[model samples]
Target chain A: MIEHLPALIIAIPLFGAFIAPLFKKKQSIAAVWAILITAITVILSLMLMYQVRLHGIIVYVFGADKPTIVLPSGYKVPIRIMFEIDGIGAFMAISATLMSFVGALYSYSHVKAESGLEKYYALLLLLEVGILGMVLTGDLFNLFVFLEIAGIAGSALVGFRNYRGEASEAGIKYLIVSAVASLMVLFAIGILYGEYGNLNLAYISRQVSLSTLDMIAFGLLFASFAMKCGSVPMHYWVPDAYTEVPAGINPVLLVSTYASLYALFRVSFTLFANVSISLERVGWIMSVLGVLTMFIGVTMALVQKDVKRLMSYHAISQTGYMLLGVGVGLTVLHNSDALAEFGRTAMAGGIFHIINHIIYKSLLLMTAGALFYVTGTRNLNEMGGLARKMPITTLCFIVGAAAISGLPPFNGFASKFLIYESSYRLNPLLAVFAMVTSILTLASFVKVFASAFLGPPLEKFENVREVPRPMIVAMVILALLCILFGLFPDVVLNKIVYPAVDALINVAQYQSWGGLA
Target chain B: MISKLVTGSGYWSPLLWLAFLILFTLIGYVIYSRGNPSYKKESEQVKPYLSGNAEPSKEKIQVRASDIYWGFIEALKEYYKVLQAIHTGDVRDYILWYLGVGTVILFLLVGGA
Candidate 1:
């Protein structure tokens, strides 16, 4: 049973999604069912994390007598679908599942008054399945399948409020963007398949030759994943999609974006690790995009009147830090001295930021949701003195706001410190841009805090009260995590983040798990 | 002993920062406690001095979100013009950006290859 944790993580959510509609008439039961399933998935994901930490990577092959079998019956190639659970994958799974579980609990009260609770729960569970599958799968085609599943479910959830024209419009735009991006991914996979006659990522990594076609496939995969992850110049869908989603769905959607990011990193460090392509140039590209994303995202966030839209822009800005860190790592991949000097630290910062961002950003978005639930509005200009009514949310918002701004004693600061120190060694300008962005992020959130939560109590909101207990519980869970990760950054880095960085850097080990020498 | 996160070039210890914060906070409290013992809450002396004008409603007094960074936006009006123009909120324009960026990246890769 312990060995089957990988399959159980995916199967539980997928099965839960299928049976979610059975309690259509019983929305309360449906909510509990969704939460229960997600909690189970979260436990299983943590178990998988422990297993991977104790042992090494766990590669589970589908349709095989033993979970360890990658290639069957003396075959040179692995044809069966498989899940390659490395440290990074397990880390992401834990983050994604935990976020989903909180999302489920938050949604229990958030969407209670709304209709179609059954479909909402179903789509939510499916979204988890998609994210989990994408992070865990060893096969490229399986990744595509899960990406579409996430994309479709995400689009539906974004437009879940069909009464709102903006929601429908955002949903359509997200759907189109997701479809085009997925198609590019499929085309790239096809190119790889044509070149090496395999779809398994580990197999392709072992057999890749740096031909012109391989480079094209690499380009497609890179751009598509980058676009999916909301990198700038191609990030127009982010604000629209992120703002329109049901408040409870925002974190899960964000996790899906990180799944795309995970795919991007997997491609760069593992699939194309040995390819003769110019990694420095690719790294420069990512770094440039990172700087641009950080600057533009914060600036746009500065002027937004809508609370969720403001937070959405900040989300994009934060992604830039990750890109910059990992891009620096990629730049120095072949040089062992440089990699040891700062490259690994840079990568570790980026990977650590992924989980940290998920926690704090999700908390911030949920606070926004809580505000909307009570005030019946998302516009910051229309909100004031919310702290008087919603003390828990106010505290959570402060923690989230400070963390996102990279303030000390918070997780964001620790990660950004790593990125800034390492990137400064590479080039001072990169760190300058990062620090400036952090300052602007602080300024933007200060505006939000003052406009929405501070000032004298308003007459119109005299009756406004705190959100439901479940919502408070959800937000508190994330807030505690933010403080915990902040106060004890070393514990998180040593226990969780370093192993992921090590797993990512060890391309030989990744390939070996796939039966490659 | 609190663990320090050593990042090749430098290190950070949250415990040390916390200790410094606690020390400064205590110092601030001691200084604060030395002043304003006679001050009273909910008194006429504590009310806002509006230059002999009547105080307005709380909502009217509060600054709106749009007004938070008026000077910053005004100073960067030219930059914001181009930025806002690019964000036309049209799905067609977004797709165009996607294609445009994707094409550029593709050219770079294939050309370099």
Candidate 2:
């Protein structure tokens, strides 16, 4: 089971995705099949986490007994494709699949009356497969392949309802940006492959010299991945796409965004670990990007009237926290003792926020989906007094709002507290900016809550009811996790988050897992 | 029963905070919930006040969502103008921004190298 788990994780979804269209005749069946595929993928991800704990850093090379780092003829590095599952990969995998599964479950009711049901679930599974592959694959070129698959699938999903308002426009925008980004990533890979003569990441890392071209390649990869993750100046497409897509699909898209962020970290920490560039300077550059993203996202969110668009901007803002945490980690990369003192905590804060943000952000979006499900509109002015009609959705939204705002005793505050306190140790201004962003985030959500949910009931929505049970169940699960994780920060900190941070910093363990040493 | 999650550099224990929050919340909820009924619903008491003129319909009287944060938006007008200009909603401009950043990064990083 351990030997075949990697292949199975990707294969189940890849095969199941194609089969999803077959059940088009029965749309309900298609939805069920999607749920099953995603559920199994989630379980497999959990199992991989357990297996990695029992036996550290499980390496499953494709078509070989060993990692195949040493070719029988002569070469001295890994040549075959491989899947490396460590604590970080498992954390992301489980988060992605778990969210994807929940998104599918919610999609059933949300898209039931809409057309293109079959294509919707198919793209859903394929998107998850792409994200899973991107995180789990050990080969650099293979990572690019997964990145393309995700990019394409994500673009199509963004325009699932192409005939509707601005959906097609958003899709085209996303496609063009993705094409440009992918080309940049591809050119970067070409440079690396030309320099090192290897496509495997661990192999390339061992042999890569910090030539001028290599530095250029790293810069290209950084810009492209940062754009893919919706950083500022590169984030204009985010609000358009998030608002246009079927609300059920937004959560899965959020997971994919995290996958791109994971790529950014992996490329910098592992791929360029031994490079000759001033990592601390690079870290400062990334820190500037983080601060800009946080401020711009919240300010733009303040002026938006559409509910989904408003939350979409917040998603970009939340990405800033993760970037900031990791940026601090990189800024202090030189001193191992200092890194252990605060850098690890910063990485842990960033990675932990990835987990927290996914839960609360998706829950908030699904509540927005439920609003659209009944209200038939995404505009905030048109929605009023919903709390009286749909109590469950209201409750879920409150939990999500409180969490996203970093109110104490929720998951957001726990991760953010780590980021705030640790980053203050590095630079007080970064912490100050982060805290201001948090306050602005709260203010923005309050506006949404007041205008959209808590106002006097609109006459048209007199009969509004709670969302379907499956949708509510999905939201309840996320909400429960938010509260639980918040209450027991120490448990999550010790058990899941700190381990992933350790895996990230320990590039040697990753290289040895590839059998490069 | 307060326990601390001391990570050496940072600590975030929700125990004391949670206790304080629950205490204040209960006190607030009790005071707010104790209010007696002083007015009738669907009566003249429920009518909107509009400086002695007849009240407009709810939709007409209600504030636009965008208007809610008008002051903040105005204060950040210069910043927003630059931002909104960059987000021109045109595909060509979007690509330009993407390339423009790519070029900047290429120079910034390669120059350092």
Put down candidate 2 lDDT per residue, A1-517, tens digits, no spaces.
6668888999999998999999878999999999999999989998887786777677777876554333434656667788887788888888889899989989888889887788999999999999999999888888989998998999999989977859988988888888888898999999988877888776677666667898899899999999999988888888888888887888889989899999998887888877635577777777788888998999889888899999999999999999999989987877788798888888888899999999999999999989999999999989887888888888889999999999988999988888897888789999999999999999998898888887666778888888889988988998998898888888887777877787788888887773434
Please give the range of 10 consecutive residues that has the lowest summed lDDT in model 2 chain A.
A66-75
Best by DockQ: 1
Q: Which candidate is the best by TM-score?
A: 1
Docking class of 2: medium
Per-residue lDDT of model 2, residues B22-105, tens digit only: 999999999988988676787677667736778766667556577788898899899999877777888887777778887887
What clash pairs does model 1 have? none
User: What local distance difference test score does each model get?
Assistant: 0.92, 0.85
Q: Estimate, for each residue in A324-438, the C-alpha lDDT of model 1 and write its tens digit.
A: 9999998888888999999999999999999999999999999999999999999998999989899999999999999999998988899999999999888899999999999
TM per candidate comes to: 0.98, 0.96
Error of 1 at A46 (Å): 0.9
lDDT of 1 by residue, B1-113 (tens): 78688998878899899999999999999999999787777676655673777888888888899999999999999999999999999988887888888888878877777
